[model samples]
Target chain A: MNPISHSPLSIPQQAYSTELQHHLFGRQLLAAEIPFSLDVLETHIEQGYVAKTFGIELDHCIRCGNQDKQLFYTFPCAICRQLCTYCRSCIMMGRVSECTPLYTWTGPAYDFHVPKSVMNWSGTLSEGQQTASDRVKQVILHQEELLVWAVCGAGKTEVLFAGIEAGLLAGKRICIATPRTDVVLELAPRLKKAFPFIEVAALYGGSDDRHKLAPLTVATIHQLFRFKEAFDAMIIDEVDAFPYSMDPSLHYAVQKAKKQTAATIYLTATPSRQMKKQYRSGKLQAVTIPARYHRQPIPVPEMKWCGNWAKQFQQKKIPRPVQAWVNERLQSKTPILLFFPSIAVMETARPLFQNLPAVYAEHPSRKERVQALRDGELQGLLTTTILERGVTIERLEVAVIGAEHEVFTESALVQIAGRVGRSFAYPTGSITFFHYGKSKAMVEAIRHITSMNEEARKRGLLDG
Target chain B: MGFSMANCYICYEKMRKPITWTSLFLRQPKSRICSNCEAKFAWISGETCAICSRELDESFRREQLCLDCLRWENNPEWAGYLTKNVSLFHYNDFLKELIAKYKYRGDYALAEVLAPFMKECLQQLEYDLITVIPLSKDRLQERGFNQAQALLDILQINSTELLTRIHTEKQSKKSRQERINLPQIFRVTSRTAIQGKSVVIVDDIYTTGSTVRHAAKALKLAGAEKIETMTIAR
Candidate 1:
């Protein structure tokens, strides 16, 4: 029944078999989702062209590597006619149950052809960016893990162009995974422009490139759950971002998505406490870029006591100091971003700011409002911590209206401060922390910025 | 089934079942979904068609039947096959997404999330036997479980496999005319079990009412006396 020698298979069957092979290569797919009939898949299995394993094996989901017993539940399966266990952790991708099998191509691997010249980026990297870029290339070539401890707005993405190009020249598959869909949407276009000759598949929740095979893939880390041992090199952008830093399943997914010896480059502005400890202990190799590409220091946040903002908000009044800060930015026509502790507080205080646009995680027009702020259509915007990272607005003044709130972690506050002074023409801006009371996170955030500035000055990475 | 910290099946948020004087003494049924996600479901209420339970506007409430049900009843070939259908929720966007995740995505736990609603509607119906609308062999294997049967299983209700279906393309892909005009797809299984008995057909959703009607016709021809249908959504 083997069709390798063109046995008696019909034309359509042959075409489907070839198409299945191409799609299943470097990807793990649910058996039910495979378009071809089981008979054809069985033939491929007999010919050693495909391998199938239980979707959930040994009480863990093979695709997403979820092992939590609480996340696994059983249902009476119609096909098996018995109780079958399934993983709820990755059920959003598609249910991976014990009775189901995950299909992966086991035949010859596809060779990705790369063009002679892959790097098409015209802009030059600064001194700090160039040094970090060379280190990334070295790490990829040696198949080692490297943590790029770059500050925000330090041209981290530019540093990866050289490493990605080198990996492509070596005919290796590379994947750039980030925690947020916003980062994937932002990076996909930039990567496509940088490597004009190669195909780049950007995968997210509802992305249309789910089945496309390309040499380079940029996707949300959740999308990496669908792949297994697929890439030769992996770059995790925003490594310390939410859901990725807190969720172990995502960490397991990243580990499962790459080859055993694959190089991993972790790019993060504020490393997690655990990551920081590991780097200091020499457990993980590292490179640090402390200065922005404009050869300027990060904007330090100034603490200003705006007394009892919550009580004032209950009375439908903006705190005196907070009101003064908004007036200054509005009068000077300086575009500003005011971060609130929560969406409820932001909405309550929104009408107080002349009904300026408020952007949060679930705001419907968040992208348009941010774009409007960038286009100078809006003088200022009120936001939550969702804009803490992955957003850069030049000459933008930022303030945390309730900096003492528990949501304002040290890393979050630093990232918020990093949103200012991003462009070369405007390398200095003011950041104010208008808090009712001081918290340990607020103090540490200030110290974090000051130390980074001092480190940059000591290394002469900043201009005199 | 037991009280513990459970994540919402839809949003994955940690659902805290509030404790109260009543909850302390009585065993409350744990919710599988959070309140926020639960609030999004539009419960079918107010005036609805007598036959298919499709929601009707105020102007159409006097008609007592929706236009689709009227068309079904006007045809002698299909009239009176399905005695009545009681649906629990409206087919809003949220319910559409919930059903898609449950049926197409193989999220079997959603059956538990939907069990209470289904049970509340089924309790008021009088029937000798409860049966799920059968799925074709290909579809059953692909989805791993029959959605209607899962609802019954979650409620600990015993349902007889009174009907078998022939393998065919998905009903959603067919147009309304194509669905109404298709050849008989269900065959009665074990005629003795359904003969001279009133049967209630359980299904995930009652869209166009063709699927339940076909099942009812097959059971009716095999000697069932009365045929009624219960669905989660209209």
Candidate 2:
């Protein structure tokens, strides 16, 4: 196991502890960061005293439960043992050895200074959004699980304001978690602005707010591992997104992060078909907003067969249609986002597009470049699907060079297409699928987007 | 989670393994620094100064000793300075950043970066006693560790504090004369015990010969027979 070796932080204890103990009690904290030494805390525990019943549940890691972990790793850990058995999974976050004690406080919870007015936003929700928001608020009050199946660009963040306000008024500590840092970065400022009175901390890797306690936490789902029964409202946005959908440890973290009676609201533009089946079978309470916030229909993707694209790249040349499309976009002075299946392939073809000024290519490792696209400083960006979700570029034309590749799943294709036409100012834009041969996923993605637009039109949610 | 391969601690790049029969029978040398980042490290190899072991600039065509070491070698007052000083790496920006990350940034895991070198130095050297440069309690409290002790700890090597540092103004903030003149910062804690025994002094970095020279003088006056100094980088 690669060890969970966090760089030791040297923050002054007084700076964050007072707020931390107030907001973080009845919750879990990173083992290394608690105010008192573990031995001191352990001594207090051994003398027939548990600090908080919610605290000091010492069997496995609180974050990413070490359920199937094996005792293979041996290390000289002063806190645990000279030889310690660490969990292999979630080791990226930190090394969670069996001896590392994760404590929580079972409360007669501390008193929260809930503000009289939590939300300062005065924006109006559309009728469909209003119904879903009301339902979300009701479900939170009832402490039930619900899924918000809203379309991409449906103002999903705005729709949650009412529900979050209701939670705050009821003196419930809430956490908004997502699978990726991109979403956390995008949502945190918006949330803090909406609920100005509530102290909201954005938690992510290297974030200053990691120890500074606040009643409201906006964090990546990976960060929630250190939280146990921490919140009354645990809203996982982009719940069907990668890692969250693919990794079970994240699910385990979410369960540990929220109270047993806490409401869990899953918000996603593309919930799985299995989830839909579960919703149909009454396993989950569900609501859907078919229309986008812009009141304009999504543009359906058009398929253009660019024959032997793989061969063309092998010959070190961009296919005619792909070059022509880029030329046309550049001629029109429209910024575009071209999605490639892999970084290796995209980088291979990067020199071909270098003729266009301000054109760049990026992958998951190069997230800083995404800002250049967002600032409209670039003519276009050649990207892998890391930008498939949680990115909004106005008037951006999107094209997928290899839409039929196995990497381009139906859900992924939908998200890639959803990147176009996100803003109200640019309510509609083109999404083109350039493929070697059409795969079932490509067809499904096209059908899914068309059906969604059709449904929005039928519901009179589209602008006349 | 569940990394089947080790990752480079400094840059956090995963160390990928390529299959070959050499790895089948004999494992490759384990290194915390991957080959790519490893190339960035300017090691103190090839020709070096005889006294302080700093890398020799070939253009100068100096003898075995560098100018500073030659300055000491030529000086009757500082001649020999007890024995020799050995260093592992050149104090380049790459090493400077690494030490900053390890010592100042409080990344203890980065101690692994010096583990193999520390081990090789420890194994090759013959010493009756192994001691490391110590941090004053105040500095220790601030750093949460002794930078020198961390390198020894990574390899599970035994090291004791032969001398303790006083709370003087930081050596780096001073000039060469000010540093050498600052004070007798080190005191011989157990002079009689080290009598006639060879000792090796370990430190994290060796910028000038001043700190180690002072330590060697203290040890020599305390009746130690021989004193050698080694650091992860110069």
Candidate 3:
């Protein structure tokens, strides 16, 4: 059995009473060198822990040992009696309210299932996707480690189903971890429908399935902190997503969550140079996916320069070429997605599009705002890289305003382009990047897409 | 030549499995208190301003606010009402020692023991969202982590990194007056996201309460209905 680690220490036990130590341990048998005597522990058990730690006085509670004006008396909760001033005013008192519990989300409850018609859906697999699925299938069957290197829109998620189904059939516990909630929410329902019988969980921030640790979990990588060698087979989706890719701690998290006997599979649209090198050197088993699901070549976005767009925007004059392009696209009623380099530029450019009638929005907003982008309620969506992954809309043309800004790195630009031409209905669309100056990243992004298209074409992936 | 020596060291450590500190220390009977840092002082929970952690006498009342928190004087637009505030420690060396391990060290083991202590400190109150004062993007990038985020994560509380610091500067270098009078240094990127939401600001230490107060002011400006603050150390 793997040893489970605990959360960080908040209070020094030596400074605390015997009762506090018992409370920290909880009822569950925790494996640790707890610094306490048996007699002291027994004495604490006789009287409750919270009362000893926080003494109540004359209708007011001694909150962190501060007794000021009288606060409302709330009965002791299972956890503690000392509520913060904010919790004191809560309608439910100090109880854990309906705010989703922080844990993994397994498939819907036992009785819940999506309709059967949606389960057997299939689409054309790109050469990159076919190669990835084959590699993942081999990994799960043989219990071997493998890495799948695909460019964006190479249909990595569909390739995962075969491997996940293999794990489920074999009765082995599996977890697919990513670094973002958007990906987890998107993948959870898809995975659930694909393997309806097997229990699948989606674990991310604000998910309420803590106690429901299923055999399989689709989780954001941050939630990996809670597990210790708990997974038999682990697949990390979007292995190159931000923060996760940048931070070594998250990499440690991936390694830590996998059981010794488990096979780890990494699926990424854009593999880091280090990973690519490792694959070439035979240090990692590798597969490549280089085309969209529709087998159409990824549309290489054309780059245009808008000299001093920010300065021009402040003076309330939209660039003629850019304005003409927007007018043409909007006249066609083609929903557009305009990417900006930074929030500052996005805010500056937002007013320019207001009366123009192109629908615009930002990330981390209400579901309705994001929904507007997909429902085509807005003529266009103004966005940062926050909408780069796990979002797909049909028949949308994308333009990057100020694409040459330092924020749009080679990888980021590649991802932004990947957002174009995702769905089968809109296999190809016009993607133009308006910049003040041409950048190496911009060229690299175009080159990256063209190269992938070249690979897919060489494999005879494209149909006339 | 180095391979054999390294192999021998690895073999030696591997042979000594199940290392036991209890067995080693059993021979020597020792006191419970930390030997290095003597208990020089006890918990001195004296009368303090409920809002700002300022020690005060009987003159302070719920209606009569602290000088920093006086709504009309400090922030005229916002009412600036917090239910209550309190602290167990004075942000001294002892609290700093504990915080270093809790934050930088990835010592989440300490949080399991300490979170309840924070919970105990959160006296009776109603909070809608548990929020932490966000670290500047540059600071977060340099630190490779947010200490406050880690603490709240361990507490298993619902928190949002909503209020982003637009500018990166050494906050500690400025006086309380400079901090209050400081220009609109922070911005609420997610206004409607937090509108009508109740929030409790969590931080490692609260000194003058200016930082949390400013954060609360920003949240309020974004149309947050109510605000409160709690810290590990006062």
Candidate 4:
């Protein structure tokens, strides 16, 4: 027997997307949906002249990524590569490189992929993906515009492979714009392996490879300011994400960055009411994926209002059902994640759970805490919404302290709920909400999930 | 009241809309003989330095050069390319007061009145395009708008952001040599677009000519064929 095989893997381990598989096909996928027009591109090129020459000045060292506190020209690290200063840590690691890719990209293509070494990796697909992929392919081939709407967990990333393949095959430049840096880092390696032959550029706040300026660029939306109608196709992911959605400047930037004849695509999970109104009015076009690939119904976690909750916990007593649930998980030894609304409450209740012998952790604690969670060194973690997106932990039971907190919007709650029941082997799980007051948003969120799960079940795509 | 009545020297009200009058006389209750101490100043008129916009004091004063030419700080080979410059009044008390109010007082409506004077100041320095000195981002945001650009719009000239500031500091506080020692601060943008273009650099004043000199340096680097400067006051 394999010594590491004391417990069965809860989910079928997915094969690492090899670098060869990435290159086997030639295209790329974008993170957002953007509009394209030749006129807009020309205008951007004309207007962005001043922005091109504006020199960026930094007050401190770039090597250690320290800012403001460090002085210029002093404590220079020898690995110094760019105009910016480097620090001792970067010098020791040989990481002192200039900040590159400030100017928009030009030339070369490559594939990207997520390496298999990452844990808790389970991606789902839907029939809509093939249709969406085909649409993107057609848009690129004909230089058209497409709008895509996928429900949470609808496997939107995989759909881009086919579109990127077409861009590479045709030798046209492509770019994917997102609002978050974490997403860019997460997506870059995946694309690299998925199409290794094509040179791909991943741009974010401080990525080292930014200077290469590849033909295919993956960047945050703010970086688009440096470009002028530069891409043959521009994809804007999470079209409904905050700050990006609210800022007209970003929308204008995307429009200005695409070629007059370029293809533009938009992707979103929870499009705003205004977008829906426009789509209904035919001012915009859309395609949606409403089901998960697992074909299992999305689980609906019921909320229980535990009034006077602090009083109950102070009596050296935990709620009977909640205690029973934790005890069951302890007996089974399944790692669990307990979410709280604030760090203060987590501190107060942390001791209550210490007697159970399960390691407890929360965010904003320390870098050590996050590492501990990743290493699976802790059995249960109490956290805030900081971990809502871009984090994956395998086979964990999940619970929430206050589902009705105003901070947990419909979109946030949905994304939080998405954390559970992700793997094929462990496609079913329990989610409990301990709320002091019930909110309509909570009801609406649960309803939305049930409807999507019902649709997935109807399509026979649920995993378990 | 004779001194006040002496302000009425150029008093013809029907002088074809009197293009750009000094704000000292125009922005006040019209007792107009040039009210601030009633000092007489030469208004830039006929043929002058085609490049520097230096006024011709006399018809026979050689078509394109001025008294300041002996100390001019640019290449002579490029000297004759620009037209005449019309500086409305010497940088005196009355003009200085109006400029302060117009530039720092958030008085944008004053731009409508000032634009024509700026236009009249350049009556002899014929230019194909006009551009205002570009403000650094920090300064522009603080002031809400560029004053020179606001007035230039009234001249109906298409403008571009051709210069970028390397650093910005108050010029009045710096000495002349310190001003000269200041590095050439403007960098050219869209070099190919400005090739062989003749441009008139417009500003509120012409103190020491440093800002215009820097701006002219950028325009020259960008291949501007001829550069002339025009100001409401020198």
Candidate 5:
């Protein structure tokens, strides 16, 4: 028979050391996952090539920086044979127990040599976009923070090209993080096309580029937990999105993932209350792009009383006004997006709308269905709040079936309204909010859009 | 206890335990997993093999043993070492992922999710001593916990360490024939405690049954009166 197999570390020491260095640079990995023997790690630690910290210490997760005691749990560890505390907050990535050590390379860093001119994009930015783009570059050069409070369809991603190029040419690493995976999937390709020379690592939950050391990275906020002060410049897109706005651990991960002197740029269509308060108090450097790249005002949503739509849905009938609106869009051959409060309501009312394709957060073919609507292969699609942001369809007319539901917060409604009139080819479209009774959020959403339009008009940023 | 709220260990969803008169007067046990996640675990029921507790089809009903067990029984060297093996769940895809997350990824809290089922199964078995299949020192350092022992700890069952495993290549990479042909990997640690006592062996999964059989053989050779195996999946 064959002899016992050797561990992975049995490879020649030179090749193994280089491989370990490649994986450990700019990353805080568990000691068990280092792929080499602990003796080698200890030698590296003694030589000041690696820094090791307890994975979890005194109810704190050093890797993810989760300090909440409720998120920590204890279990009897077989290796230590003692009660070990683990962080449940970031357990989806990997379990960080008290006995485990997080390793980071303190040796020479990975060198990224970028081209002189990284940006290949030829499109011209609008007057509003140019202002925000200049401010972003200034923030990056000064190593400061700035909030770009741009309206939806204002080409926020395009505005970051110059800033990213500046960081790249200066021999700095940059990362663009969003709260959702959909945004990462949407942004990575466009950023790659713009900066064709720079390596862009698109990291989400099962991304292949998780271990790649790149000059530029586009990732979800959750993916930042594995990084340790890895970026010289960090851009947070969709700063007001879910989980990022509500979860404190994600905020901690963002801070822990960036260098202490790194520049930060927050991009959002609807900033959180605290962010807006900071802007109003002159504590935050901010710029507002109220006009779309097409130099057009945002389409304000019109509130229409649909008379107890939920009750009507229970009767297996669509509301009269909502039905009329769908027919109007269908007759005109305009693609439409109908937002429901929840998946159950959307599925229940789906049959009444001539078998329109419905999508939610958990829908298997959510991307394909949204792409079909964008390509005009599907006339209209029903969706939940998951499609409120990061989905753009040309000439798309939007309507919210149950706008007064608690799920339709003011920011959500504003995002839903922003879905209309996004494309420059068809920069004008209709948005309607069909509700049983007008809620405060519906009114605020309408006011929020109207004020942005007025702001663009006052500044002469709007063409019409 | 009044109405209480707890998050599931598996999915982290908030579970609301409704208050009733019995709950007010009695100390109700809290659920470790939410109903949605708990429903995914398929319990082993209906017809099963008498030897290894593998769910059997109707075609194998006549002999009451799976074909693999028949092969093991025919081998004189391996015959009658393990009395029987009882498993709680079928080795379905969900259980496969759960085991990977629990045992390989070091999510130690997941043992609590399987503790109730294991406790129920162990209550019906007649054994004077219970012990878990030992992991090699190298394997234990990598996984950070012995999955089988973790289940016993969550159930509050004190298990004895009767066997120590010799380091070998991972069993998952070996074929069926190779696994069966492998030599004894376990050495009895405490011969006196196992002498003349009925023993139970616990493991995470019963795939080829060779691992437990090896442990049973070591215990049987150590003068144990009887040996049986218990596992979370087969």
Candidate 6:
């Protein structure tokens, strides 16, 4: 077992992949990876640039604008302190210290297999899906930045199948990148089934498919750092999702992964205000599908005023209204999801709901509980905002314990609301904001959902 | 009811625990691995082999040497050459991966994982000086750091390069019998430091007892009074 083989072992066929080839020749190659491309790489020990060469007191990460936070996780490194102060922000991927060398492949790039047809997803697209799918094809040909501002459960994955097939038919490499691992897991199988002939690999931390090579790839954005100018068309799912929305390095990775002339697509249910402004300014071409494939009205969240729920939690008690709501959901056998503002709040609430034996509370540590919930073992799951996206239950009902908290931003509230009325079997369910007082974010989230439904009605897209 | 934010190194799960007090305070100076990873180690406690310090199964005689050490006793020239050997942990898959991560992947932080255990194990033995088995010049440059030296450098005791291995095929590539039969690769250097001193030789692993035996042979020939072996695992 050669442990240093962590580099994606690109076979000669895979090495010739536009994506893998770009990565092979990309900017950030580790010292160990250089030997694999020894004949191709232009060799030079990359001493992290000479700051004083131009007489600048230079100390800022060119990659992510990371200046400080070094004192937190990586104060004194084990390796040469002068040579290895290690960046803390991106340490989870791999340590990037001053002494780390970057290799550049100067060899000729290889060619990957160009199939005659890549579109095999035979399922008929809804009218909305068809329009969005057509826009994707146009965007790829024009190499424009496109944003697919579709509502949640709008067959967003189906819309991509057409464009992916289009790209594959054109013999252009493509990547479907998302911020969350759950999306990668959710999409990999559906994508593989849609285009069964093409190899599909899903890359994530400790993923079983980490080393596999596929012409069509689905990976979390973090994995994009492994590529450089690789994709001819790049589709970014949930472009405004957390961690990715906050981490500037992930944004940098997305830009670094695609070709300079590559077409870019950003898909989201709730786009940031900046994205809306970008669309208005004609900087990004916009496509919106406000209704799901079922064309049912979205379940707008109703504010349930529970006076002093926080005070109740401190007293080691769930509020009467909250407990009553849980009892109601349990009795009706509605597999519900309760979103607490914090993990601490969720834990304090877990014991209070034990009357419902099948009811479980999950925070970060309780990832295993998610599996049980998916297995239909749990009737209800109490979670933090971690499950707001990337989770789907056929008839799942959702409630926010404290929707007014700062953590429940406008974008997050929209995503949490989007969780409900997702599957076709239900298509409509109660979404409640059990709050002490309604914040501006809560009000804005209601407005956002209402407006999307209004637009769906005006377009005559509703099934009713 | 609550979960920890700090992740376990082995399972990479956030649920196992928060960082322990020992990890917070002493792991840096001692062994810095997470408590969960430290727990995975099967510590060699209780009565151990008089020569190799490997834990004796109930089937083996307590007073007599273990099977590996007993074989050394068969060869008069190798017998009594080393006073004793002390190993801290059993060489399990976890330790194997840990050592591989350090030696192969160049993850230097893992070297600190067993520093404290090694310190405790060594305190029980008596040696005038400490030295580690050295790799050939080419292997040394290739790996950038000696795997054994990375472990010994953590100890407060005196560690010096008193011996060297002449260029030879890697010990891992050789079969058990071939490894036992290979000509001695070690040559003692700076005998002035080793001469008239009881020495403890350190290595990452004590496999087949061939490496420790060969190093001990070279040290005894260099006029060392007594030779002992110390390794992180056996």
> Taking chain A by itself, what TM-score does each prediction score?
0.94, 0.87, 0.72, 0.67, 0.93, 0.85
Native contacts retained, all candidates in order: 0.70, 0.00, 0.00, 0.00, 0.63, 0.00
Write candidate 3's Cα lDDT for B74-190 as tens digits: 566435555455555666666676566545432333343345556655546577777778887656543334666656665567687678886678778899778767766668878
lDDT winner between candidates 2 and 5: 5
Judged by DockQ cut-offs, the docking class of candidate 3 is: incorrect
At residue A376, give the lDDT of candidate 5.
86
Ranking by DockQ: 1, 5, 2, 6, 3, 4
Tens-place lDDT per residue, model 2, A292-335, is: 88788888899999998877987899989898998999888788
**Which ranges of candidate 3 are over 4 A from the true structure?**
A1-128, A355-366, B1-234
TM-score for model 3? 0.53
lDDT, candidate 4, equals 0.60
Q: Of models 2 and 3, which has the larger lDDT?
A: 2
Task: State TM-scores per candidate.
Answer: 0.93, 0.78, 0.53, 0.48, 0.91, 0.73
The model with the greater TM-score, 3 or 5, is 5
For candidate 1, what's the TM-score of chain A, rounded to 2 decimals?
0.94
What are the per-model DockQ values? 0.67, 0.12, 0.02, 0.01, 0.54, 0.08
Q: Which residue pairs of candidate 6 clash?
A: none
User: What are the per-residue Cα lDDT tens digits for candidate 6 across B1-120?
Assistant: 343355433343444444666557775453244566768898788878888887877676536678777877878867778788778788998888777766665554555555657777
Candidate 1 matches the true fold with a TM-score of 0.93
Which pairs clash in the backbone of model 1?
none
lDDT of 6 by residue, A1-464 (tens): 57566443322332332443444543344545333443333221122110111100146443333555421122233334332344444444444455554444434543557567655667888878889999998888777889999988898988887777878777777899998887898888898888877788798877987545467889998887766667888999999997789877788788877889999999999899999998989987899998888889899999999888877988888888788887888888888888989877777777777733222233344666666666778887877787787677777888899888999998899898888888888888988898988999999999999999999899889976
**Per-residue lDDT of model 4, residues B1-234, tens digit only:** 112212121321222224345634567434323433344443555555544455557743444555454344354632443343445556666567656655653333445546655554566666666777888876664444577787776567677777778878878799877876687788887788679888877777877666777788678767898777777777
Candidate 4 vs candidate 5: which has greater TM-score?
5
